[model samples]
Target chain A: MDSGKTTKEILKAKLAEGEPTPLYNPEALAKIKDNFAVWKETVVQEKDRKNWEVTPKTILGSDIPRSLLYTPIDNENLDYAKDLGFSGQEPFTRGLHANMYRGRTWTLRQLSAAGSPAEVNNRLKMLLERGATGTNLALDLATVQMFDSDEPESMGQVGTVGVPIDCVEDMEAIYKDIPIDQISASIVTHYPRNTSIIFPMYLVMAERRGIPWDKLPGSVQNDFIMESVVRSASEYIPPRDDFRVQCDNIEFIRKYVPRWNFITLNGYNLREWGTSGITEMAVAIANGVEILKDMGKRGYDPDWVGERLAFFWSPANDFFEEVARLRAVRRLWYRIMKYRFNCKNPRSMWSKCHVQTSGVSLMREEPMANVTRSAYHAMAAALGGAQSLHVDGYDEAFSIPSDVANLLALRTQQILEAETQITQVVDPLAGSFYVEALTNKIEALILDEIDEIEKMGGLVDVVDSGWLHNKASRYIQREQKMIEDGTIKIVARNYFRDPNLEMPEIWVKEYDPALAKAMMDKLARVRSQRNNEKADNTIKALIDACKKGGNVMAACVECARADVTVGEMRRAFVKAFGLWKTPIYA
Target chain B: MASKKKIRVLLAQFPLETHSRGIIAVAGMLRDAGMEVILMGNALPKQIVETAVQEYVDVIGISTYCGGELALGGDLMKAAEERGIKKRTSFLIGGIFPPKDIPKLKNIGFDGTFLSATKEEIVSCIQSAVAAKN
Candidate 1:
C-alpha cells in the first residue's frame, strides 16, 4: 500500500531523529566557562564594582534581551547544515544566491511617484537616468483608496501622495517612453482590490506597446493585508472577498505574466503602520501560508504559485536585528515551503524580498539626519541579502521627496554599491555569534507568533476580527509613549532637542492644484472618448465575476481593455461584494 | 458639585489619506488625558464636520500626513462654518505638513496647528483651545 507521502515529508520525518550535538566540545566549553568566570571576577568585577549587572539593558523588538556578549555557548545546538545552510542551498540562511552582491548587486529601486501621470513619468525617466536600476511606482492616495480623480472623496488628494491613474490612458501616459520590457517596475498597488483594478491597466498598456505578457518583469503588492490591516481607508471589502481577489490575481498573473511577481507579501507597510519586526514577518508569512493553502484548494501546485511569490519588508533602525531578521525569515520561509507545502522547486523555497527603509523612523526635526538614518537602514538591507532596495528620502517625514532628495536617496544606494566593500562578501555577518544567536531567536519568535495567529483562526479571521488591528494599536501607543518619554531616543526629536540649531532648508514638493484639475479633465476625456458600451459590459462582467467566485483578474483585464476606469472597476467589485466596515476601532 | 464634563473630541484623518498611526496614537493619548474621543477613519471634511455637529464635540483634530494641507484645512474650516460650528467647535490640524504651511492652516480658521508636537504639548493645546472656546 502506498503511504502517499512526499519525499520532503519522508526526509523531514527521518531527519527529526534525535537531539543535535553541540558545536564545541564539552571540555573546551568548560574551559571557556572557567576562564570567563575568572575574568568576570577579576577584571569585569573590578571595573564595574557591583556584580555584573549592566543598568538599563537593551532589547530587540521581539523582546529578546541582549547579553553583554555571545559566545559558542549561545549557539551550541546550531547545526550549520540544518540551521544555517550554505548560500543557495536548503535552508538558505546565508543568502538566496551563493555569491550574493558579488555576482550582482541588489536593485537600486527608488520609490517615485507624484502629481499627474506625465509628471510622474518625467520623474521616473530622471531617476532611471540618475542610476536607479528599477522603477517603483507609488500611487496617489485617491487611486490607492479606489476613487476616481473626479470623485468628491478624491478632492484635495489627487496626485498628492503618488501618481493618479484612472484608466488605461493614464497608465500609457505614465510609461510613455519607458521600455516596459527592459526594466522591472514595482506598481505599488498596496491592496489586493486595487491591484486587481490597477495592474490590469499596466498589462493592457504593455499589450498596446506589443509587449507580451510573459516578457513583463515586475511585481504588484497584491496583499490583502494592506487593505485589511495596514491602510485605514473610508471603505473596505470584506476580508474573505479581498482574499479571494488576492488569490485570483495570483492565479491569473502566474498563468499569463510568468515573469511577474504576482504578489509581494507586504510587511513594509505593516511594520510602518506600527508593529514590531517580528510581528511584521509573522503576519506576512502567515498571510503567505494562508494564500498557499487557498491556492492549493484552487487546484494549483504550491511550487507553481510560490516561484513568482516575493516579499516586501521595511528594514528599520535596529541594525543587527534587521540583518538577523532577514536571515531568519529566509530560513523560516524555506522551512515552511519545504516541509509544510512540500514544494520541490528551489525558487519556490527562496524568500526573495525587496526592502524599503522605514518611513516611520524618519523624524521631521533636523530632517537632514533622516538621510543618515535611511543610509543605515539601506546598509542593513544590503547586509541582510535583500534582492532589491528603496532608500527613503529625508523629506519622507514631510512630503514626497523632491528631485534633489530623491537623487540623494539614489546616491545612498549607489555609494554603498560602489564605495563600500560590504558587497564583496556574501552574508558578511553570517558567522557572528551575536547575529547567529539573534537569528535563531528571531526565527523561533516569528514561528511562535505565526503559530499563535494560526491558533486564532489564521490571518483572515484575525484581520476580520480586528485582533491584528488591536495588536497594532497597542504597539502604536507604546511606541509613541516610549518616544515621548525619551525612552526611545530620537535625535533632535527628543534627546538633543535644539530649537535654535541652524538647519538646511529642505525643499518639499508642493501639491499643484492644476495637476489635480488636469487629472480630472483627462479622466473625463477618457470616459467620454472610450467605448462606453464595451466599458459597461466589461464592468458588468467584472461584477459577475466578483459575485460568482470567478477570476476577477480576467474580468479586470477585459475592463482595462474596454477603458474602464480604476474607480469604476472597483465600484463593480464593491457593488458585488458590498462594503465591510473595518474592525479598526474597538 | 457636579464633576467637570470630559473634553469631547473628534479625531479623523483626511479623506483618502491612509496613514493612521499618528491619529491612532493621538486617540490613545487623548483618551488617557480624560477626553472622550470619537475616532473616525479617513472621513471627508464634510463628514467630519457633520459628525462633529451631530456629536456636538468640543474639539476636532484632523491629521493629514499627505500633502495638500492648505486645501484640506481650508475645506474643513469651510465645512465647520457652513455647519455654524466654526466658533463653538475648536479645530486643530496635525501631522506631517510643512512648518511654513502652519500659518496657512491657522489663517484658514484652525484653532491650533501642530507639527512634530509631543503628546503633552498636544493635550495641553487641545485643553487650552477648548477652555478658550468655552
Candidate 2:
C-alpha cells in the first residue's frame, strides 16, 4: 500500500493536467474554446463571403456528422481492432498490400485517345516512351459502348466521344508495337458482351505473334452491376440478361485466363454520379459480394473468382477522407468475405483497385488548376495504396483529354514516384491521431452502409428499384445547385477571376466525315466478306445458350470468330432480352 | 388555296462528332422564340434528305462535335439541295464548329453557323442570318 501510494505520487507529479493522450480528450470546453472559435470564424467567413452554410454533412466515410466540428468524444466507442483493423491485415482498414507503395508504385494511367486507332496507337507509343507503365483505352461511345457506328442512334458520332474501336482490326492496330504481355491495360467501357467478343481478336493477334496466353497481363472492363446501372439509365440492356452476361464471363475467365482479372466493380462511375465515398464503398462492396454469390451459385469457386476479381474507385479532392475510404473498403471487404461469405483463402479478401482522380472536380475555368487537384488526389491514392490509377487531364472538363494534358497527368504520377520519395514508407500516415480516428469512423460507416444494402437484398435490388440512380441524380442535383449558387466555388466560375491569361488552343479532332463513312463501310464490308451462314449459326448458338442456361461466353467466342460485330451481337441479345426501362422520377 | 404560313425548321442532337447540347438547346429555344423547328435525333447521310423532304422544312440545323463536322454537315447540305429543297431552305450548324471552318460551311452552302455554349447570344445571330436576303 505504501509502494502503490509512492508510485501514484511519482506518476501524478510527472504528468500534466488532463493531457488526454493521442485520440482521447479530457480537455474542458473552455480550454478548447480556441478551436471552436476558429471553426466559428471559418463558418462566418464562409457564410458572409461565400454565402454558403456548412451543414452537419453526413458524407460516406465520415458518419459522425458532415459538420466540421468533431469532438474526440464523438468517437469514444470506435474500436481499434473490431472497428479499425491494422494496415496490411484482414479488414484492411489501412491498405491492401503489406508493403503498399514501398514495394511497387501506383499505376499512372491517364484516360487517352484521339482520331483513329492507328493515330491513337502512335500517341500511346509516345506516352509509353515518356514513362507510362500502363495504357488505358477510352472507346468512342458509338462503336464500343453502343456497338454500332452507323445506327440511327449513332449518327454524327464515331471516334469523337472516346477512342473508336470498330472491329478486331482496330483493336489489333491500337496494340501493334505495345507489348500487352509486360504492361497492364484498362479499357473504360461497360460492354462485356462487346468486350468478350472483342477480347478474342487480341488473343488471335497474340497467337500469331507467339505470345503465350499466360503472359497476357491486361484487364477487361467487365463490371456487370456497374454496367447494369449505367445501361439502365441509358436503356442499353435488360437487368436479368445483364447478370447472365456477367456470370457467363466470370465462368469463362475463371477457366481460360487465370491471370487476367475478369471485371473491376466500377464504383468510380457511381461516385461520379455523386455518391459520398462511404456510399461508394458500401454499394461497391455489396456489388462485389452479390457478384461473388451469383458466381458461387453458378458453381464457381469463390477463391478462383475472387482471385481475378478487382475493383475501380474514384479519389476525390478530400485528401485524408479519401484515404480513409480506401482503407475502410479493403477492411470491410475482408470481414464480409471471411465472416459473411465464409472464405478461408487469405488472398480472397485483398482489395485490388484501380483508382482515378474524380473528373467531376475538374473545372472548366482556370482549368490548369486541375493539374494540382489531380496531383493531390493521386497522392492520396498512392498513400491509400492503389494498385493502378488514372489521373484526369487539366482540360478534362471542356473536352476529352488532349495529348499535352495527358502528358502532364502522367508526369504528375512520375514526379510523385521519382522525386517525392514519399513511396519509401508503407502507410506513411499510419499512426497519426487524425488518420486513425478517421479510419475507424470510415470503417464503421462503410459496414453500416453494407448492412443497409444487404437488407435491400443486395446490389440487384438497389439497381432494379432505381435507388442508386435516384441517389446519384440527387447527388448530382445537389452538386449542380452548389455550383450554380456559388456554395461550391469552382474558381473562375464562382470565386476567383483569371483576367490576363489567354485561352489556350483547344485540341480537337478534325471532323473525319470519311471516318464515320469508313466505319460503316468497314462494318458493311465485313458483313459482305465473312461467311454469313457461319455467323448466323454462331449467333443462333449464342441465343440458344442464353435460353438453355449454358455458358454464353463460349458462344460469344464463336461469334467473334464469325466476324459478328459488337452491334450485331448486342442488338441480337437486346432483341431477345428486351431493354431495361428506367423509372421516371420527374 | 394559296401557300399558307407555317413555321419550318430542323432539330438535331448527337453524342459524338462534337455537337454541343447547348447548340441543340439553343436551336430549340430559337424555334420557341417563334421559328419553325424540325428536330432530328442525329440522322446520317441517307436519312437527312428524307427528314427534310418529309418535314418540308425551311431550314436545317446540324450539331457536330466529332471534328468532322464540316464535311458531314457539308454532305447533308448537299444532299438536301440534290433533293430539290436547296433554294427554298437554309442550313445552320452549332457546337464546336470552329471559326476556321466558317468559310468551309459557307462553301458547303451553310447559311450560318454559331459556336456552342451561347444560347441567348446566338439568338440574335440566328435572327440576323434569317433576316438577311440571298
Candidate 3:
C-alpha cells in the first residue's frame, strides 16, 4: 500500500518470494498450435464441407470477430502478476474483493419511481419489503429537467415517468418514515445543473430528519456527459460552464457529504443512447479524467477524490462483451490511477460500478420475453463483478413498471443471488482463453478511443464541436439498420416472425390525471405559507454565486432551507449563465 | 414526363421529453427516401402545428417517449383542426406507447401509430399516407 511503489515494483514484491512460471511452456504452446491447425484442417474442414458450422464468426451484438475455438495459445502473452493480478490487489482485473460475492452479495437496487411523491414513497417501501437491499430513485421528467410540477412547460408530464419533486417538502414526502440514514439511495439527478439544484433538497431533508451529512450514504448522477452528449434536450448550458459546475458539486460534496458519492460517471445513459460498449467506457473515463484534472488544479488530493468516484454502466445483450468490458475497464482504471495520477490507495484504484440492464435492449413485442432478456443481462452484470445491479422491468418498454413487473424485476436479482451458485467463486470466467483475450482486446480498444478523445481536445471540445453528436447519430442509424435488415436478430422483432403469438395481459401503470391539479395546489400552499423575503434573498445569493463562479451548492443548500422550488433555482441559473443550444439540435 | 413533388414531413417532440434516437433515425430514413424532413426540436403542440402549416408539410409526425401521449397528441390534433389543415396533413405518432393507447391515438385523429417499427415499415407507411393525401 506504499504510495511510491510502481506497478512493476509491486508485482516484483508480490512475486519475489516465489516467482510463478507460465503454465504453458514454449513447447507446449507449439504443440497446441500444431494440434489446433491439424484439427482445423481435418475435423473443421470436414465439417465445413458438410456446412455444419456451429460457432458464430463474431461476438453477438458487436463487430469483434471470434475464433471457432480458443486455447492456451490465445493467452500465451498474458502476464499473470501484471495483467491478471490477484483479486483485491494492484491492477485488479479479476475482482475487487478476494472473496467476491461470497463475502458480500451485490446490492439489489431497483430504480423505482412514478406518480406523486407519496406514491413513489409507498413503492419504495414496498420494494424494500419485497427484498431490495438499496433504493435507486428515478425522478420525473419535470424534476429532472428542472421544472416545477405546476409550470406550464411541465404540463401532462408532471409525475409520468418518475416521482415529482418540487421542493424540500416533496423530498421529505418521498422518504417519509423511511430511514435514509440506514439504507443507501441513488438520486438520479442526472445532469450537473439539476444536481446542484435538486441534491441540496435531499440534504436539507436529511438535516430536518436529524441525520448528519456524513451518516447519509448515497450517490448522485452529477455527470456532465448526460448534459453534453446523451441529453436530448434542445437547450443546455455551455459544456465548459457545466463542467465547472460539475467540479463545484464534487468539491462541495467531498467536503460536506463525506460518505456520499458526488458523481456516478454515467455511461449507462450514453450506451442506451445507441453507442457501442467501447465508446461508453471511453467517454466516461475521459470525463473522469477531466474532472480529476480540474480538482487537482483546485488542490485536492487524487486519492481522496478518486476513492469516491464510481461508474454506472448499461449491460446490453452482448453477454461476454459486457462482462469483458467491465473487467477491462477496471484494469484500465487501475493503471490510470496508479501511473497517470500516481495514486497508491488500493481503494482509489478500484473501479466500483453499479450496472443497470439495458432498457433499450428490451422490446415491446412479446414483452414477457423481456423478462428473460433482463435476467440474462443481470446475470452478466453479476458475472462481471458489479457492486450493485438494477434489472429493467419487463414492461418498461411501454411505461414505468407496474407493481407486478417491479416485483418481478427485484425477484430476478434475488433468484440469481439465492439459487445460482455462480457467485461462489471470484471471477469464475477469469482463466477462460476466450474471456482473457476479449478483455485484452477491449482494453486496447478503449485506450485507443481515450487517446483519440484526448487528441480531439477532450470530452468538452468533442461535444461542443458536435463530433460526439455525429458519432452517436451514426451508431444509432447503423444499429437500427442492422435490426431492420436482420443482421442483428431480436426474437419477435426481426428474426422469427410470429404473427399468431398471443399478447399477454400486461398491466401498464396509468398516468394520474389529477396529479397536475394536486401538485399545483400544493405549490400554492407552500408559496403562501413560507417566508417570501427569506426565499427571495436566498435566490439572489444563489444567482450571485453562479455569476461569481463560486460553489453554487452551498448557496443551494441555503435555498433549500428557505423552501425555494426546483424551478426557481433553475431559473436563477438560467438568469445568471443563460443557455446554450445543444449542438445536436443546432 | 414531369418530376413529382417531394413529400415534406415535420417531426416534433416536446421540450421536456428527452428521447430522440427514434425521431432522429426516422428523419434520416425519410430524408433518404427523397422526402424533405424538418426536425422541430422541442416544441409545444401549438408551435408544432404552426411550423407544420408554415412549412407546408404533407405529414406531421410526433415522437413521444416520456409519457403525456394522450394530452399532447390530442392538443396537436386540435391545433391542426383549428388551423383547418387536418385533411391536408397526415398525422402520425411513434415511440413507446401501450397497445391499448393506440386506439386513443387514432381516436385523436392520428393517421398512424407505430411501435417498434422497422425503417422500411415507417418509410412505406409515410409514403402511402402522403400518397393517399395527394
Candidate 4:
C-alpha cells in the first residue's frame, strides 16, 4: 500500500479532481460598470444632488459598499471544504456544535446588574424566572477598579452601572438562593487582576455551598487588551502585569475549574466604543495573541489556553454584513489557532462566541423604533449562527433597561427562537451568492487590519505608543461628523422627524437613597466580624506571593475565604507594583 | 483682520463614567467649530465647577448618562453658584434621556441640554450660548 507520492502530493491530486465551473464573469461585470457609469451620469447625478450629504455611502461597518445589486460576479473560487466545512467539523465556519441550537437553543444570557447584591440578586432571579437560560452581571465601577464601596474614590458610584461587591459576603449574597450549579452565570469584568480576586470569591463561595468547581458553569470577561484599547486605561494596571494575573487564572482554572470558560475576549466593548466590525475582530484576535505570548513566556500550553477561551462580539445594524462577520470570525479564528498558535485540538480551533446587538445603534428620539432595529440585528445573529445572543433593550440609549423593556428584549429573542425555523439548520446563510462573497471580503479586511497591527509591533506596542486609542477616538469623532453632515442618517434625527414627537413615558429606576448606606454597612460589618488577625495575615501572604512572582491564585483563594476585601488586595498590588501611566495622545 | 477672542468653553463628565467617548467627540467638534474647548476628563462635580471658575470659560457642559443622574446636574449648579460662576456661565447637560427631562434640566439652571443632539445642533448651541453671555 505504500506509494511513492508524499501525503501532501496525494491530497493535492485528490483535490485537483473535477472543480466546478467558475461562478463569475469579468466581461459581465465590466458591462455592468459601463452601464453604471452612464446611470451615474443620469440617474445617480439626479439622486446625488438630493442625497449626497445624507450618507457618504450605503456601506457596512467593514467598509464594503452596498451596491445597487449583488450578483456574485467573482465568487467562482469558493471551495466548500476549504472555505467552509460542516458544523462542528474542521475549519468550523458554520457552527461550533454539529447540532447547534437544534441540540439546545442559543442561551438567553440577559445581563442584569445594579448597586447592591440583593438588588442584582432580585434581577437575576427575575431573569431566570422569566425564562433566561443564563445570566450575566456587570460589576459597578468601584468593584471593577478594585475599590471597597466605602472608599472615598467610590463615593456615589456604588452599585451604579453594575452590581456592587465589596467582600466575600457580597458575592455570596449576589448569588443567594440561586443554585450556581444549575444556571450559567457570567461576571463581566475588565481587568484580569480583578478577575484574579473576584473568581476566587466565586469559587470559595461555591465550594462552601458543596458545589464542585467543575460544575460551576460560565465565563469571566477577563480580556485586558480591549480594556486598554477602548475602556478607561486608568481602570487597569499596565498591560504586562494585567496579563500576568490573567494567565494566573488560566493556569489555576485549567487544573481546578476545568469546565469553566475562563476568558471572554471582549471586542464588543471596542465595537460599542466605536471601532468598525473588522477592527473589532482583529483587535480581539490580537489581544488573544498578546495574552498567549505572555502565557507562552510563563510556559502555559498554547492549545490548553486557546481551547478554554471564548469571545464576546457585538454586531451592528448592517444585516448581511453582521451575518458575514460572524462567519468570517470563525474562519479567521481557526487559522490563527491552528497555524499561528500550533493548536491541534479541534475544540481549540473552534471560535465559540456570545454576541450582543449594538447598543450605540439605538436612537433616543422616538425610542420605540429601537425595537425594530433590535429585531433585525437579532435575526442577523440567529442567521449568523451565534452560540448565544443578547438583544439590546429599546430604551438602552438612555438608561439600563427597565423591567418592561428588559422583558420585551428577552421576548424578542424567544420569538425568534421559537417562531422561526432559523436554529433548525446550521449556517443557514452558507453558500449564498451574496453572503459568501461578503464573508470572504470581511475575512480579507480582518487580515489586513491584523497585518497593519503586526507591522506596528503588535497590540501591546501599539497601545504603548497610544496608536489604538487615537484610532478609536478619531473613528468615533468622524462618525459623529458624518451623522451631523447628514451623511449617516440616524432614525428620528436626520431621517425620521416625527411631527408629534411626544416623549413616551418610560419607567426610570429611581436612585435608591439607602443603597449606598446598605453597601457601606455591609462592608463595615464584614470588616468587623471577620477574624482580623487571619485576614491581615492572609492579605500579607497574598501580596508577598505576588511580589515573589508566583501564581497568586492559591494565596488569593486563601485570602478570599479569610474575607479580605477587594480594597486590601488592590492596595497590596499598588504597594508592590506602582500604577501604570497611560500614554496620552492629543 | 484682528484675531477675535475665541469663545472659550469647558466640558467634563461625571466621575466614574467611562462613557467618555460622547464627551470626547463633542469636545473635538466644538474645537473644530472654532471655539476654545477645555476638556476636563472624568472628574467630580466640584472639580468641574471649580475648573469652570478658574478657567473663566463661557459655557459649562456636563455629560450625564447611565441612568442620567439628574440630581448630579442640580448639584453642579449649586456648586457653580457657590463659586459665583452659575449666573456668569451657561450650563448645559448632554446624555441619552427622555424629552420630558429637558424642562427639569432647564429648571435646574441648565440653559440648554442635548439628548443625542447632532453636531450642528451642538455647535450652534455653543455659539448662541457664548453670544448671549457676551
Candidate 4 C-alpha lDDT tens digits along B1-134: 13378878887777666776787788778888888888776666788888888888989888766543576676788898899887779887887555677788789888878776667788777777767766
Number of the top-ranking candidate, with DockQ as the measure: 1
Error of 1 at A375 (Å): 2.1
- True lDDT of residue A310, candidate 1: 92
Model 2, global lDDT: 0.67
Q: lDDT for every model?
A: 0.85, 0.67, 0.84, 0.77
i-RMSD of all predictions: 1.7, 6.1, 2.3, 3.0
lDDT of 2 by residue, A249-301 (tens): 77776677667777888888767656778787777777777777788777766
Docking model 3 quality class: medium
lDDT, candidate 4, A1-586, per-residue tens: 1143322233345446776444346677678667856766787656664543331232126567644434545465666777788888877888888998889888777775776788778878887886666778898877887788887556656776788787778888899999899888888867677888888999999988889998888788777665555655234456666667777877788779887888888888888887888889888887787767767777878888888878888878889889999999898788777656667888888788889988988877788899999899999988888888888889887777776787799899999999977878888888887788889888878877876787777777787777887887788777777777767767786777886765566755545557878888888888899999999899888888777887777788989999998989888776666676665533
Question: What TM-score does chain B get in every candidate?
Answer: 0.94, 0.76, 0.94, 0.90
Q: Give the winner by DockQ: 2 or 3.
A: 3
Worst 10 residues of 3 chain A by lDDT: A52-61
Report the CAPRI category for model 1: medium
Candidate numbers sorted by DockQ from highest down: 1, 3, 4, 2
Q: Rank the candidates by TM-score, best first.
A: 1, 3, 4, 2
Please give, for residues A168-269, the per-residue lDDT of candidate 3 as tens digits: 999999999889988888899999999999999999999999999989898999998898778777467888888888999999999999999999999899
What candidate 4 gets wrong by more than 4 Å, as runs, is: A1-60, A66-72, A233-236, A545-547, A552-555, B1-3, B49-56, B67-71, B74-87, B97-109, B131-134
Give the fraction of native contacts in model 1.
Answer: 0.78
Which residue pairs in candidate 4 collide? Answer: A53-A486, A54-A486, A54-A487, A55-A487, A115-A159
Q: Kindly report which residue stretches of model 1 are placed more than 4 angstroms away from their true locations once superposed.
A: A1-15, A18-21, A41-43, A46-60, A499-505, B1-3
